[model samples]
Target: MDLMFLRATLLFILGVYANSLAVAKFIATSGRHKVKVICFSKTGERAAPFIRQAAKDYFSEASFAYVLWREIDMAFWWNMFGVDSAPSVVFLKDIYSKPITYSGSFNHLQLVKMMDDYKKNDIPQLRLVSSMELGCDARGYSRSGNETVTWYCLILVGRAGHAMTQMRETLRRASDVLMVGDDSDYARNVNLSVAIVASAAMKENRLTFTWLDGEVQQKYCQFHLAPEYHTKSCGPSYEDGVDAPQILIVRYLRNLTDDNAKNDRWKHFRNQYLGDTKVASQLIARYPGPEDVEELIQWISHIVERGDTREFPYFTFETPDLVPEDKQSMGSPVGQSFSRGINNRLKKLHMYISDLPRDPRVGPSLLLAACLLFGTIWLQNNRTKQANNTPGDLASSTSSRGRARARPARTDDVPPSMTDEEPKDAYQWVTTDSDSE
Candidate 1:
């Protein structure tokens, strides 16, 4: 009877311990219980009560709150949103999640519509796409292939305007994922992701329609670029050009501007750096062939299509998907394909234009500097290695390290040579004071 009672007690205790451990583990791995949203306002009171109710009613699992900032926290804010603006709400599990942000104030109905959209979290698997950590800017030159891709959750392609619509459509299609569009959450919602795509230009407005009586602006038009390009002085609107009907990249560029003057800077970068004549020349030098453009385009198509989806992303807009097929691996064909992408944008033209300009501020210069810096580091490493091999030091240091944990020699194991002095005439050949080496 006593033995049975003891056994039963032990069994009960074991079950209780196992249950407690399981509960503890569940809490540790599952993450935050309540969503923590941050609503931002420069206008203050106009957004107070609505902010509170949004958090309480919708994100009951989230700890929703408002953060009024006269001076936006660029350091933390942009990282939270792809870019930051006022009267915004961010929704997500926590700031650590880098939740999504939607900008601007809205009426009760507008707010509800926006919230309904925010709750629709897509991109279920927040792929690394890049190996970078949380806050690095995946967009600029720093995110070249060699830099060990940093914290890029997603990387969008194409600049703003119609491209934005295309990209947004793509995101919507990817059911299980959410992407970043700005530095902070648009509002305090916390379920979306944080990111932003820089705006450049659209050749000065391509869409025109007469609406609302006398000339209403239809910036809302989507397909700005024709499917292909032709060579001519095709102006912004169809009425501007009749003979030379071409896809004016100029108009596409003009469409990229915004209140921030980003379109101008982007154009400056594109013309001086991205569309340089010299870069194209260098490419021709490298991959001079009759069918180079065709080959190059195929290569890029393959790589871009696969994207960096296999690995973590390095930047917000730069997907790690495979490059064009020819540029699939960094093998010769793929490498040449990349060269073509850089230099061959205007390959069909007689005037060989480089994607990068001669100006110094261009990204190529920065890229070159980085390459040189890395080369210098490699040279430094080689120099250090050569210096260490100063006749006999290399072998000695390596051997010494190898022997660090070796067992000590016992008295009985001592060799006769080490234990006793050498004979006076050992190997005293030829009677020379200075022996021939």
Candidate 2:
């Protein structure tokens, strides 16, 4: 009775442990774009109520999970993400990237601020994967779709610094001002040209706002800026001071008269063959005015007006592609196709393989199976050799060889007799031995 009770207790404990592992894995993988917050605690202890409230408030922006700390997984958590102890929190922006971890306790305000910071950036950085989704790449259509032929991309390029942050905030405010209705205070305060441009841009969804890292994308920044300003604006900072962020606004124009179906087919062909070519002719102009919000807004409004109304020389050039923030998130054609066909089977196989090391029976069972297989193969080979070397088989083979060697030659099997001398012509005969020709 005691033995049975011990076995039941052990099984229940193992079941609970396995369930915790499954829950942890599900939490890690389920949310793709949203921020993932994992709270770790002792088995009986619960996380702060504010953490749960934050998760509820930011449900749309983030995913939250609670993991019970186990001694067995202590090293895994510590080495993989620096979670050294219980009562800790981990914030994951994406599955592939390293997570941000906090070991100490925090209040509700701090927790909320952290969640807000992790959910999304104030102004998103332009990247290869995001360029397509945001419709900022020349190869992609505008946010308003194919009908919108003329669109603008406003980019603020700079390395990470106080100046870059301030300029980014100013740009964000400008974009916000444009996004709002004309009745807003920002619209009323702006000049007539600025108001008109903002209203038109808002209505048509013709403008996209993004930022680029100048230090990382030096070539791209230099390509957009004039040769003289390249040193001033792009690359690493000099001993003098940090480089001020510069604004670049590009006006893209796609041919509207072409057939839509033909264009689509050609676009697909170009994507497959020509790679990341320029699908639109663009006019690029750098902002020369001060970084003040009002002045920046005025300059942008003027540029938009000119791009929309005035005729400019249209040019096509290859632009550098933005680097991907998360390489694992990018999709491959073969990977997508394979996933679509065998996703479920692959998941099951992956789970089974992952569990193999954990399950105590797997190792011994595999070893036993291997031994059985080897023994069976060895016995079969031994039987085959023994059968071939049997006395009756060997004697029969030797007798057959002896008969072949002792057999006499037959006339039927031999060709007609022929001399080993030169051949005779039709009119002459060749002599053999003593005969003359």
Candidate 3:
């Protein structure tokens, strides 16, 4: 009984853990991506294969799910995403945005095109993971490599708005102009200063163009942007009632002088104090100018020409890490998904166990429950043992009483004098005629 109770308690805990894990998984996937494509099908005849193939191509941009259709849940489909039938696809772009539903057959090319159109925005937002890759992070080296000591990052920082959109378009145009080279018609049409900057950027391959969400990354924006512009550029829009988009150019410089003595001294210092630190000293400069393509290009050109020739104040600080856009790219889709699920479950379990010590109610509550369970099991075992011996005890007592009652009692009234006269017995046998016959 005690062993059974222990097995039952373990099963109950496992059941709860499984239920909590499922809930955690649902929540983890909810905010994984801004876009989610779900295919509803009664038999998964065509949509399943199509969605699976599409997921492989656009795995980094959007998430996909396949749901089996049931007639009983027809109203739920319609009311939620207006998906009233099987063989339909619903694209949920955002939490508050309306869903886009389609119910027709589509070829692979058409599906890919549609996904491309919907999955990404006009300008990719700079995230923690992409910052280093794009050479926008101070601690990381340039995308061109360590040999390229100087690099520039052109960023448009602001909240979402028409102004921000227009600025992003201008930034995109500037990037395109640079990519087009000097002989292009667009380059010739541009001003001389813009052309010079574009030419220098193309020749060096040291410039990267990206955008930042000022509201989301307020600390980074505030740190880089001038104090006067913080009200108009960074933080929530409601605070200043202004969402003016601003462009900032960052220049990064690294020193690669080979001094063995200096290197050895620094190495010794790191070993003694820092202990395996990867932080390096680098100089950074921010552009303080209006948001104009011509001026921006000219500033970049000047920085490229004379940035290394001059000296600037060098500083080091920890920067915020960017969120990765392609977390599922490391392995096969199925393996990645399975590993992610296991990791999430283990992380949740760890968190739950870690919190138990901190929660004041958990310790005592668990102890009380354990004591109650043990007591119940002990009582059950005791009752079962007694019940098994009860019938044997009753049988033994009854047999002893029967034996006692079966014994005959001797009385004092009976005389034993006739036994002593044995001589008369020899002649007494003739008196009994029936006995003699």
After superposition on all CA atoms, how large is the RMSD of candidate 1? 28.7
Can you give the lDDT of residue 86 in candidate 2?
A: 79
Which 10-residue window in model 3 sums to the lowest lDDT?
271-280
lDDT (Cα, tens digit) per residue for candidate 3, span 1-437: 99999997787666556644643464357443345777777885555566677887766556777777767566556877887787777776444345678886566787777676653434456765456677787655677775577777778888766678678777766676666666667668766544565466655658888888787678888877778878788877885388887776777765343212243544533432232333234444566677776666777677766654666665555654433435445455456546544653565355446544755676798999999999999999999988887897889989999999998887678787866667644755436567667
Local accuracy by lDDT, each model: 0.36, 0.70, 0.65
Angstrom error at residue 293, model 2: 1.6
**Segments of candidate 1 deviating more than 4 angstroms:** 1-31, 43-47, 95-98, 123-437
Q: What is the TM-score of each candidate against the true structure?
A: 0.22, 0.50, 0.51
Each candidate's number of clashing pairs is 105, 0, 5
Per-residue CA lDDT of candidate 2, range 187-276, in tens?
Answer: 677654555685577567788888877876788888888877766678888888657788998888875433232435445433322433
On a 0 to 100 scale, what is the lDDT of residue 196 in model 3? 69
* Residue 85, candidate 3: alpha-carbon lDDT: 80
lDDT of 1 by residue, 1-437 (tens): 99999997787666556644643453344333333455677755554676557655663234455555544244345643543777776666422344577777766677677666764543221111111221111222112232222112222222222333333333343212212222334312332221111100001111110101000111111122232221111123344433221111100011112212333655444543454322110000011122222232232223322332333222111223222211122356456546555543443232213423533457777899999999999999999888966957778887887898585756886567753787766784575466554
